[model samples]
Target chain A: MEKIVLKNVCKIFGDHPQKALKLLKEGKDKDEIQAKTGSVVGVNQASFEVKEGEIVVVMGLSGSGKSTLVRCINRLFEPTSGEIFVDGQDVTKLSREELRQFRQQKFGMVFQNFALFPHRTVIHNVEFGLEIQKSDLSVRREKAEKALELVGLKGWGEKFPSELSGGMQQRVGLARALAMDPDILLMDEAFSALDPLIRRDMQDELIEMQQSMRKTIVFISHDLDEALKLGDRIVLMKDGAVVQIGTPEDILMNPSNEYVAKFVEEVDITKVLTAETIMKKSQDVAYLTSDGPRAAMRKMKNNAIASLFVLDKQNKLHGVVFADEVAKLIEKGEKSLESAIHRDAAAVSPDTPASELFAVMQSISHPVAVVDENNKLKGIIVKGLLMAAIAERGGNI
Target chain B: MSFELPRLPLGDGIEAVLDFLVHNLAFATKAFSAVADQGIRLMETAMMAVHPIIMIFILTALVFYLTRQRGVTIFTFLGMGLIWNLGLWSATVSTLSLVLVATLIAISIGIPIGIFCALNGYAYKIVRPILDFMQTLPAFVYLIPAIPFFGLGRVAAIFATVIFSMPPAIRFTTLGIKQVPKELVECADAFGADRWQKLFKIQLPLAKTTIMGGVNQTIMLALSMVVIAAMIGARGLGGEVWRAIQRLQPGAGFEAGIGIVIVAIILDRVLQKLSKS
Candidate 1:
């Protein structure tokens, strides 16, 4: 389901926006229109869609209009011309009052500078949106408390925004947005002001929250690495226009133009390619509860592998059974593959970075098992496949 | 030969307008002035009833409570004691009441107008020139119409002082609100805050220090106009200085002038501390 769709949106900032917009429609570029009409084109006929439960990062340099574009989604910056549809409703057609009400119910926003009200306590800042919506005092307070807890500031509610560090202030910002429980989150360079380490933690925190919450998010950023880390699909914008839109691998592997290629060229692929992206499908595995030692041995033989991953009825990774152990168990007439299963096999969550795989794989002789949160086997990463995945991505493997 | 431009009738035109306003508006103005006169007298009597020693202690306590600064508290205590010792305690109280009432009126009107100007560009454009004219006009100019409207009393003096001191509060308020960070305004808007919500919740709170600075300036401006107000029968410390000057008693003039200075400094320090808090 599409949550937000912007069509031919153009934002001309000046006294004569309509005149500049007319020139824009006549195929005049931003500079020509600016020189001719003295109107700067903030966003020039940019179009994009954000799907429900997907995070789409709008990445660009300083003047690329990413911020303007995101603001246009909620009509914070009214588009000079074009349609903005959110959940099938035309947002541009809304009256001022209607837009205010619509924003209260549909969207949440976080800003780069944290934009927390210095006069407000942390909990009060978080409660602002709910209070605007006229929610009950008790209800909003409970929601605000829950939001603060969600952002890991459980006991810092009474502190003013200035009392917190930059990272914690941003957490308050995120909590402020989350308190509204809006369907879509528009984050404008939300973590750009933080130190690199804190920024990374915030990115991980957002991703972790998104795993269960699954709210549609449109994140604006200038840093390529941040976009790659957080965006499910990346939108590369330039000079007030969207140049390319694709998944991280699609963008890194096949940039639409030289500008995008250069933008992503400096990024280290090993840090981005996670186990989920690089791991191959496991060819053979034996059920620990149902399969006998002979079945494990036969499966390993058929796949021409020395060992086979063992799983129970729930498809959880029980362990790995080496062919030698299986053969010994078969010679001893052991019926269950559990006797042959080796529980010490190395495993990694699917989201672990490929760079970390190198460290984990160095000490393990067998293939690393890629598992989900429930320890269910998702894929396998043999050493050769990991190397090939890196080399294929143009890494210095 | 030098050609002279025809002398504009600007002064005559203003005089005519003032004449018309005086004729048509004096009834309402006089009624308001009576009420204001009664209020000032009431306040003056209430404040004067307190013993000078008691008043000094009360004021020092207030300063200490507000500022929590040992230096300022001591200065306030000594300053009030010196003014009392100079036999100008009653005169100082009158000046304090006049300045306080005028400042309160200026702030009450100025801040809202400032907020309106900040939010509406058209209002600001229209008001900006008027504010500049009010600020640049000689302070005594307000006394002319004030005399006819309020009839030569503390009310008339307060009228002129309010007009003279109001510009800073209005100008500062508009500037402070306008200077609130663009990103913060955007954040407020993004959260769907209404006009009132945005003003009270974000803009006003952030602009507090600047607004307070403006109020402080208004009070100081009001104080500066005291001697001029004395020319219109608004007697206080200004009256004592006026009498001394007329009699050529330089010692008495200095004593009264120093008394005004002490009062101004104490008020300024207390207001400065309040603004910071």
Candidate 2:
């Protein structure tokens, strides 16, 4: 199910938005149209959909309207034109009261600066939304307590926002939002105010939480790595227009335009690329159920490999056999390839990030066998292929 | 040739307007003065009903208990004792009555108008300059216009005192509410708080200390009007001072003035403590 859908949404910020929007639809660029109409284009005809239980990150440089786009989703900034549908209801048509109620019920937002009410105690801040929903005092308190605990602030309820550190205050903000249990979580640069290490921890924690809760979250970020780390799909924006929308790999490997290519220029590819993107198919590789060592020897020679990984018919990894071991086995008239197979074999999974492959490759001189969860040998990661992948992406720096 | 610019008849215009209102709405004026007369008599009689000696001890104990400042309590005790021993106790009580009534009424009127102006842009635009004019006007000038509405008496004095004192109350409340952080206001809106909920729960509470400052100013400004108010048939330390001035008795005038100062100081300290707490 699509949780959110925006069709030709445009937010023109000025007194005469209708006039500016008309010029925008005439194919005029933001600068040109803005100069002519005296109106700044906040978001220009942007369109995208967020799937249920998926994290969609809208990412860009400063002034890219990434922040504005997220605010538009919750109607914090009403779009000058276009339709926004959430759970099949067009939010643009909602009246002022209904819109406010919609925001309270369906959307929970975390801000860039941690916008916690400084005057309120941490628990009161968490209970604010619950209280607005008219949950009685005791119930609100219990829910607030649990929400704070979920954010790892278990017992600091009585303290004010001013008493907590920047990161903890943001956690309180997250807790405040979470207390309401809204269907969609809107995080607007939620971790950007924190120190770098704390920011990374917050990103990881958010990812971990998403794994269990499976919330549909719309996150805005200017940092590419953060977008890649937490987003299932990214909507890359530029000058209030969506330049591209794709998965992390799709964005990194096949940037659709020069602008998108420039955006990916400084991306740390090893951190983004996975084993699946680089692994080679293993259809003709050696297996334990196959004939004698001669068959393995012929397969190794044909593939120009000194060794071959052996797998059972069920596709589970049996072991590996080097050309020397197979040749020795053949001289001894060994019939089954099983006896020649080395019990211990270096292996990696298809999802193993490319950055970690170098150390694993350094630990073992042989190509790494990529295995699935059932110990099935799905593919192999050669050291040379990993190096070539790094070299190819290195120019982006 | 010297060509002179024509002077505006702004003063005449106001005087004419006041005359018209005094003529047309004398009934409202009488009704208001009656209420003020009743309120002042009630407060003064209550204070007088409590013996002066008892009032002094109560005030000192209150200062000590609320503020917990030994120096302030000692100062208050000595000050009130000096005034009571100087035989100006009744005058001091009457002065306290007039100022307290005026300040109480000023706060009641100011806070709502300030809140109204804060929430409505047009109201603020209209009210801001009115407040500035009220504040900048010389205290003595209020008496001239005050006499027409509430004819000569303590009622007229309180009418003038409220006018002179109300500006800070309005200005400060507006400023205090404005000073509430926009981030907090946004959070309040996001949580589905209606206007009243946001005002009472979020904005008003956050702006409490600041609004108290306005209350402080209102009380102080009203106290400043004691002597000025006495000129308009108002009784109190101002009346005592006025009588002494008329009789050419500097010694009595100075004592009455000191008595007024004592009341002002006690009121200021107590109010300051209440707000801080």
Candidate 3:
């Protein structure tokens, strides 16, 4: 089920939103509506869904509606029109008190500038949400300590925000959100304030955090690399509307528009497109010993493939056996096909980049077997597919 | 060429209102005046009970404690000695009592009004001109109405002092709170802090330095109005200064004037120390 669904959410910034909304419904452009009613469209019928435990990154430039879209989900901006459902509850239609309660109980937000309270110590900052809920002191302290520890800030709880470095302050911010244990996390450019090195560190930390916490997160970012690295699905916005929505590979391979194309034009597609995505998953394989040469011949005949992957009884990859090798083994009446298993087959892990695998692919004529760490065959990456995937890397991040 | 415009009768309208208040709101006015009288008398008696030498020592100690400046502390003790040598210690006590009571009352009312102005733009618009008039009106003009309503006494003196001293307290408080960073206020809102929580937790603490500045100004203005205050029969160093002026004794007037300056400087220092964040 979708954890959050934003259906045709529209937000206009001006005194006469109703009049501006009329023009918006009439399909007037943002500039035309703005000129007529003196209103700026923040989000124009932006719609998307975030599945449970998915990290959906909203990406855009400075004037894009990405920030406005995420804020509308929590009713921070009060979208002019449209419905927002969070975990099946109509968050858009919630009363003010209900919205406040929803924000407190369900949403944990982190910001770009690390909005830690200056007056509060690190522990107290982390405990702020619990304090708002009027949780008892002991419980707040316990949860705050755990959260600080989770963010690698266990011993620094007594220090105020001013005493901490910029990176540490942002860690405190992350801990503050984590301390709440909320179902949804809304991060609005949460690491943009840090330096590039620290930014990468924070991204890695978030990647690690989302693994265990698995909170449905809607992260807003302007950096394409950050979005591509973190998001399961990216919603790229431009001019207050959704420009495209797709996985990193989908965007890199087939950009929906010229705008999406330009956005991905500078990105290194190899870093974004993993070996698992590049490999063909439909290839057939034979057991190393249990499925003999006869079985391999029949499988190759049915699939009309020249070669097959030989696997052991445990499904561990033994080697690749060609159709001719299997047919010769069957003609010799050898029930055991151990001699047919060629152990010199080239293998690449699923996480190995297509760039790194191209050197191996160049020396071999057969498909490169993409395997897991356990030597089990996952899929195959053909030379033609690798060349095409690499050729499709014209876009930027 | 001179052009003649009809007189506006604004003064007459104010006089009529005051007249109506005196006649119709006699009981309310009496109750308010009585409460103020009791408070001033209480502070006066408390100051009087201590010996002049003991008071000087105590003032020196308080200065030392608050400011932690040995130079300022010694100067405070010497200043109190100068007032005592002038034979104006009793009158100094009375002046201290009046100024203290007036400041307490003014700040009690002014701070809330300042907060109101900061929070509500409509209230600020209404009170902006009122505060301007209160701060700018000549000290003598306060007595014209003071004589008719409160009749010449410490109550009238204190009433005038309150009106004179209140504007700075209100203005500084409003400025201080309004100056609190918008981002911090937004952060507070994002955290779901209620209005009162936001005021106390975020706004008031950040505005501390400036608000104390307002209090310090109010105290100075109250002391500056001392001589005018004594014209309404309020006893103090101001009374001594006024009496010496009436009798044309320059020597006595100068000594009393010196005493007022000493008290003003010492009080200003103590308040200044308290204001630091």
Candidate 4:
């Protein structure tokens, strides 16, 4: 089931009478509201769903409505017109008490500013949601302790929010959210306020936690690299509207628009894509056996091969040896098969995109090959395959 | 250096000044009584409007207890008793009663007005000048108009005191409410806090220090008007001082002035402590 859903949500602010008149006059479009009252449309007919256990990163620059969109999901700001459902429950229609219960039971929010209650201690801050939920004191405390331990702040319960560094404070905020055992976590630039070094550390910690807990998270950030690293799927927003929504791999390989293309162009795609895209396919009829220097040379000449894949007796790929490498080995009078071969080679699976393989090959200055699940050589995907893909798409190199 | 006439003896000079003050007091009293009689009913009405002193005492005690400060508790007790012991106890109580009544009235009137002004810039523009005028005008200036309407005694005294004391309370309350962090307000709203909840819980609690500051200023200004109000037969330490001066007794006048100073200090300290608490 979808964990959260927002249908046609929009938020506008101004005088009530004027707003009502404008709404009536301007009809349903956000432009009409803006034209009438000069009010900002914070979220403009936003519609999306977060599936269970999926990490959806909402990415936008400042004032792009990404923050506003996430806030609207929890009804932090009432959407001007729309409906929101959390776990199939219509949350937008909830009363105050019901909303509080919804927040306590289903939603956990972390703010960019940390928003740790200044008057509360670390453990007390973490336990704030539970306290608001009116859980038993001992049970809340116990839960808070576990949350603190989970966030790696186990021994710092007594310290006030001011006593901790920025990153530590954010961890306390994370622990606070975690203490509620929320179904969905909303993180609004939770790591952006920290120093770069600390941000990296927190990101690693978040990834580790996500691997274990598998909670649905809607993370908001402007940093492209952060989005690339943490997002299972990313929704890029601009001016209160979604520009693109796709997996990080999809975004990196094929950005939806020029804006997205420009955004992706600035990122180093080589480090992002794995070694599974460029591995070669093996020939079914032919197999590599113990062949002498002349035999190997004759095999290379006859096949018009630039490089040959090295495989074990079990047909598992060991590596590859270029023609020059074999020739060098022969020139050096190396007789052993092992001594004649170069085992270190770049290989990727069939699922890896041509764009990623191209990037990896460009970085390494070599042709890469495709491989299968059992580490057997599949087929070679050289610089030509990438060139052909890009050429076919009529895209710039 | 310039040449000058010989100075009078210190004792003789003192006696002469004392004589002048007494002459002025005797004349002022006759005028004060004439004003007092015109509104005797109003004075009684004003007295009837006085707040229960028990409430003030309880509040002071509660604040002191909460703070758990020995110095503050002692000051609260001493302040309450000193106002009673100064022979102007009944008059002081009457003035206090009127001031408290006026202040309560001011709060009811001021808070909403302040909130309105804060929310609407146009309203702020309209109210700002009136606040300025109310704050700047001399305390006695209010007496001229108040006397014509409420007449003399506690009623006029309260009218004048409220007029003088209210501006600070309203101005500061507006400022306090306006100055609440926007993000915190947003957070509260996001958590589904409606207008009323936001005002009472988030805005008011956060604005506590500034609002209390306004309260402190109002109480001090009200206390300051006690002496001026006494000239119109709003009896208090001011009347005691007026009588001592009329009888040409420097010792009596000095003691009464000292008593007024003590009351001022005690009230100031108590309010200051309350604000902190």
Candidate 5:
């Protein structure tokens, strides 16, 4: 089910919005409309849909109207024309009172600058949305406390926002939004104001939280890497119009225009290309329960490989067996492959980024093993394949 | 003779408007002034009934409680003691009472108008020029119409003082609320705060120091009006100063003026301390 859908939404800011809107409809672009009618187009016919429990990132530079586009969904900017549907309800048609109620009940928003109330204690700031919703004091306090705990600020609730560091302040901001327990979260550059290291930590924390919470999120960001890391599907916007909306891989592989290609040109490839994307499927593996050292050695010789991965009968990875070790085992007449297997091979989960694999690959000459969560052998990542995979994905090695 | 420009009846027009207000609104103004007069008198009597030494001790205690500043507390104690020593205690009390009532009225009326102006552009558009006129017009000019409506007493003086002092409170309040960061306002709106909630919870709390600064200015402006207010029989330090000037007692005039300065400093300091916390 779609959580949010914006159709032909437009937001023109000026004394005469209708005039600019009319000019926009007549095929005038943002600058032309602005010049012709003295009205700035904030968002121009933006259309997109966010599915349930998905993080749809709206990515753009400043003045691209990504922020405006997000705000319009909640009726903050009030779309000049067109429909906004959230859970099948027309948000644009809601009256002011209805809209307020809808926002109070459904949407939780987080801001870039950590707009925590300075006068309020961390818990009180978190409880702000509940207070507006007219929840009983005790009930709101409980929820606020739980939210503070969720954001890893469990006992810092009594402290004022000013008392905390920048990172902690934004944690309080996230707590404030989470305390509302709303279905959809609209995060407008929520971590952009933090230091780079703290920003990455926040991104990881948000991803961790999303795994369990699964709230549909529309995250707006100026940073391409952030969008790629956090978004299930990324919406690329330019000059108040959505240029492209697709999965991160789809975007990197097939940019719809020169602008998008330029926008994503400088992204760090190692961070994006995962071990699963970089690893090749294993051709052959010796079963520890069935195959002896001689069979493993023959398979390695036939495949023109120095080593072979040994798995148990259930296809769970045992370890890698080198040709020389197998030959030694064969000379000693060892029946079980376990005697020949080197159990200390480095293994990475399928989702591990290629950047982490570089360190693992550097310390060892053997291909790195990619395994499933159950330790089932999935594939192997060779040193040459890692660079080749990244280059194949349109990244400079 | 050279060509003559047509004479504008601006002053005459103002006089006519004042005349109309005096005729139509006298009963209402009189009723309001009577209530205000009673309140001011009650406060004055309560303060005057206390011994000067006792009042000094109480005020020093208050200053200490508000500021937690040893220096300010000592200043309050010594300042009040000096006023008592100079036989200016009663005059100081009277001036303080007049200022208190005038500031109360100014803030009560001014703050709402300021908030209204902040929220409504049309109202601000109408009120802005009027505020300018009220602020820039000579403080003494208010006394002319004030006498007809409030009838020459502390009430009339208070009327003039409120008019003189109220502009900063309104201007600063509007500025403070307007200066509340756009992001904070958006945050409040995002959280589903209504107009009243947003104003009270977000805008007002954020704008507090600025608004308090305005109130401080209002109090100081009220104190500045005391001598001018004394011209209409509103007795206080101003009345003492007026008497000394007439009798050519420059020493007495300076003592009363210094007394006013002491009161202004104490009030300003206390307010600043309070706002910071």
Candidate 6:
């Protein structure tokens, strides 16, 4: 089920009503108004659904409105106009008291600066949300203690925020949010203020928490690499609008626009795309010996094999022996498979897309073999599969 | 040959003002009589309500103990003894009681006003200039108008001292409260603290130091008015000093001044320690 959804969300700022009206009247598009007045349309007609237990990351640069977008989701800053539904309830129209109640029960936000009360001890700070909700003192204390324990700050609960290091203070902030037992956690650059090493640790910690709690999270960050590392689904935003929303593989291989492509260009595709993407479907055809020229040709003619995976009895790929190579083997009257087979064959898994596969193929001077787990032959993706994928995409096949 | 000293305009104005003050001695006498009657009543009430001598002894002992200096203790004891020796012990106690009462009242009124001013820009705009005027005006200036309204005695002294001392307390309290960090306020807000909760838990705790500075200033200002208060019929070491000065008894006047200094020192030290604590 979708946990949160935004429909036609638009956030425009300025005192003048006619400013937006005048822009519209003058046929000056959103870009013009955005540039002219520096009155940002923070989230422009943004529409998306985040499924339950999904980690959705909103990724952008500093002025891309990622922070504004996240804040608008919680109505920390009210949207200019939009419908926001969290767990199927339209929360935009909620009264102040209703909104407070909703926030108390449903949402937990961790800010970039941690925002822990300096005067309060860690325990008191963590218990603040519960206290505001008017929980009994003992119950609030117990819950706060448990939350501190959850955040690995059990013994340090009595220390004030100033007494703790930056990372520890951020842990207290997290504990405060967790004490509310919120359904959704909104992290607005939660680890952005930390040092790079600490940020990596915090990212790991968040992932661990998400693994156990299964809380739906919407994390905002300007760091693309952080988004790639933490996000189950990334929404790349530019100029207050979503440029692309997809899995890491989808974004890495099939970026929605030039902007998104530029963002993904420097990423190492081999690390991002898995073997499942480009691997061909398993076929029932027999494997061929490199020297068995007549038999390979016969098999190729009968099965219409573009190329056959050369494997020993263990089903491990030795190399790919193409039909043309088999024809050459036949001409040379080769008997041994080793002599006829090309040992240096480019290979990809089913998960690899055409872009990566083509790149790999271009670099290697051999037909690309498709293989599955345990290095077992699936099917050969010679120039043909790449051509088909490229053709299907209406490009240079 | 004769040398003539030139009479400056300012000096002439001063002499004229002094002559006018001397001519108004009758009104001063009337005001003093009224203050003396009130002082007697207050002392009788204090004696009946709480043993004044015992309270004085305990306060002196506490001051001496905290100060840990024998000179201060001896001076305090001798100052009280001198007031008793001058036959003004009861009147001095009455004046001390009135000052304390006035200070307490001022704190109660001023702190809230200060906090209000600090919180609201409009209130600060309105009250700031008034506080500036209150602070800048001479302490004796407060007595001139106060005499006609309250008719002298403990009420007039209290009215004057309260007006003189309140500005510092209010201003400092407001400044202290205002100086609470913005991050702290935001933290409280994020934690869902309501207005009252935020003020009590966050702002007040953080502003404790600054507010105490204000309180200290208020106490010191009140002490400074102790001698000036005698002109309005405040009976204390101030009355003794006034009597000694009138009789041209330098020894008595010096002793009375010493007594006033001792009391001021003890009170100031105790309040300073309290502020630190």
Interface Cα RMSD per model, in Å?
0.7, 1.5, 1.9, 3.3, 0.6, 2.3
The positional error of residue B131 in candidate 5, measured at the CA in angstroms, is 1.8
Q: Report lDDT (Cα) of residue B169, candidate 5.
A: 94
> In candidate 4, what are the lDDT values of residues B1-277, reduced to their tens digit?
9999888699688567756654666555455445444344454455445453653466468647666677766775666565555454555555555556666656667777887787679999999999988878777777766655555666667667767888878888889989987765665544334567568756787688888888888878877776777777667677777787789988878766776776676667767777886
Candidate 5 residue-wise lDDT at B258: 92
Candidate 1 vs 3: which has more lDDT: 1
Extract clashing residue pairs from model 1. Answer: none
Per-residue alpha-carbon lDDT of model 3 for B43-126, expressed as tens digits?
A: 878877888899889889988989999989999999999889878998898898889888998999999999999999999999
For model 6, how does the per-residue alpha-carbon lDDT over A20-83 read when each residue is reduced to its tens digit?
Answer: 6456446566778867776656666677878899999999888787887877777777877779
- Give me the candidate number with maximum TM-score: 5
**What TM-score does prediction 4 earn?**
0.66
Q: Note the DockQ of each predicted structure.
A: 0.84, 0.56, 0.32, 0.17, 0.82, 0.29
Ranking by DockQ: 1, 5, 2, 3, 6, 4
Q: Which ten contiguous residues of candidate 4 chain A have the minimum total lDDT?
A: A278-287
lDDT score, candidate 5, position B174: 95
Model 2, A175-211: lDDT tens per residue?
Answer: 9999999889999899999999999999989988888
- Clashing pairs in model 2? A287-A311
- In model 6, which runs have C-alpha deviations exceeding 4 angstroms? A7-49, A88-90, A238-243, A257-397, B1-57, B60-96, B238-256, B263-273
Q: Give the poorly placed runs of model 1, Cα more than 4 Å off.
A: A286-304, A310-316, A321-341, A373-376, B1-5, B70-82
Instruction: Report the poorest 10 consecutive residues by lDDT, candidate 6 chain B.
Output: B28-37
Provide chain B TM-scores across all predictions: 0.95, 0.94, 0.95, 0.71, 0.95, 0.75
Q: Candidate 1: deviation at residue A101, Å?
A: 1.0
Q: Show model 3 residue runs off by greater than 4 Å.
A: A280-349, A352-388, A395-397, B1-5, B24-28
Which ranges of candidate 4 are over 4 A from the true structure?
A15-37, A277-397, B1-174, B189-205, B232-236, B245-255, B262-277
Model 3, position A363: C-alpha lDDT score = 93
Docking class of 6: acceptable
What are the per-residue Cα lDDT tens digits for candidate 3 across A176-221?
Answer: 9889899998998999999999899989999998889999999999
Candidate 4 residues A152-248, lDDT tens each? 9999999999999999999998998898898799999999999999999999999999989999999999999899889989999876778788998
Q: TM-score for each prediction?
A: 0.92, 0.91, 0.87, 0.66, 0.96, 0.69
